[model samples]
Target: MTYQDKVILITGASSGIGKELALLLAAEKARIILSARNEAHLLEVQAQCLSLTPHCHVLPMDITDERQVQEGAASAIAIYGRIDVLINNAGVTQRSKLIDTSPAAIRKLMEVNFFGPMMLTTALLPQFKAQQQGQIVVISSMAGLFGYPWRSGYNAAKHALQGYFETLQTEQPIPGLSTTIICPGRIHTDITYSAITGDGSAYGAMDPGQAHGIPVDVCARKIVKAMRNKKKLVLIARMEKVLLWMKRYFPPLFYFIARKGN
Candidate 1:
């Protein structure tokens, strides 16, 4: 399927993978609707997208806030009449060990990474059902597939996200209503610097591995391809792939690797 004229709404479109995806889809002539908490950054991305496709909208929204999410989707629907695709890319990560992490921090991470997207997807369910066809793309992490060090909270949030959406994909009540979860190992982004710490503050540290991960544009392109193919799940990054392989075929080795690393 082509993206031409498709009205696609992407959260976290202010920067990184979301911004790249917006530009890529815009080039394909899709009606791009951008959402994020950063209005300035959103406007910047909108300008770039509008250069490629005339139908570009910037809707500043914090997905963690349920009200903003609902209102944002309503506003998008008001403009476009229908949404063909919804990309849930807005999320937060954690950098502290589970024990050092504050309860409040875990709750906040869950709110941003899990509940926020879940709420938005539920809000748009009726619209999708009415349209008779829609795609839901979730930006889960490799952490969602396997445990990693100093990120139990982040891992937990992603794991829950995977469970919830994968289940919905299985129970797909209507034909053409699809779900695709994209799990990236590391796509060089600001996520590291902005990752929440044990005390609920930005970690302010960018891991070397993340700083040098696969390019964001490449990741965005792959995700778009997966969405077009309506793939159930896609994983990127060699480390993540290996970990999943071990987890599935060699449980003992998976535990051994996890323990040695984390």
Candidate 2:
């Protein structure tokens, strides 16, 4: 279960959790492929990873674009002739209520958070099937499990993401393929700064909750451990784990608390 020499592809590798994961795996001497829309940031992360392992490569492309996803998947597989793990960590969040959010804004969130990962996973299925053993790590959110205020589109997209990947988990289309869905409550990352508003513009400000969330490096370590264990589902959270329990056993309280949440 070691990461040594394992060819792993991670999306959203420019910064935050993705970058942390890249560096962690690189330290373990894994063959790492970093992907993200920002080439400059990817290069920066690549340089850091290369210092740890010589097997680091960067493939910059927009996950929301289908052509880029397909090409990126091919390029990733061509890197080491196989991809042992694919981490679908590239996603954007929203920060507006459903009523205030425009249709296009919601669509944009769906494209990046839901369709992009699905498209990339689909494109890589053949390669995984050929290898007969591969891991698909999906970075879903706690919002995927239940409703939350000020994140209407983000909630919808994450829920859709969970549904899609969960179905794949049940279907077991690829006998040797494993899927791990990670539902993180909050990790102190700059994700809030890039969160989309009702009109599809960046929120550009960090929320109070994000400021007090778990550390990004801690979250990345937990994710890598979950991937190593091939866990079916993992929730990285504190109070949010309680909220999920409330949702399952105490619906009234769950809704009451959710209504007041940001």
The model with the greatest lDDT is 2
lDDT of 2 at 239: 95
lDDT of 1: 0.90
Model 1 TM-score on a 0 to 1 scale = 0.97
What lDDT does candidate 2 reach at residue 46?
95
Q: In model 1, which runs have C-alpha deviations exceeding 4 angstroms?
A: 260-262
Q: Model 2: per-residue lDDT, tens digit, 134-167?
A: 9999999999999899998899999999999999
Worst 10 residues of 1 by lDDT: 253-262
TM-score of each: 0.97, 0.99
Query: Which 10-residue span in candidate 2 carries the lowest summed lDDT?
Result: 90-99
Report clash pairs, candidate 2.
none
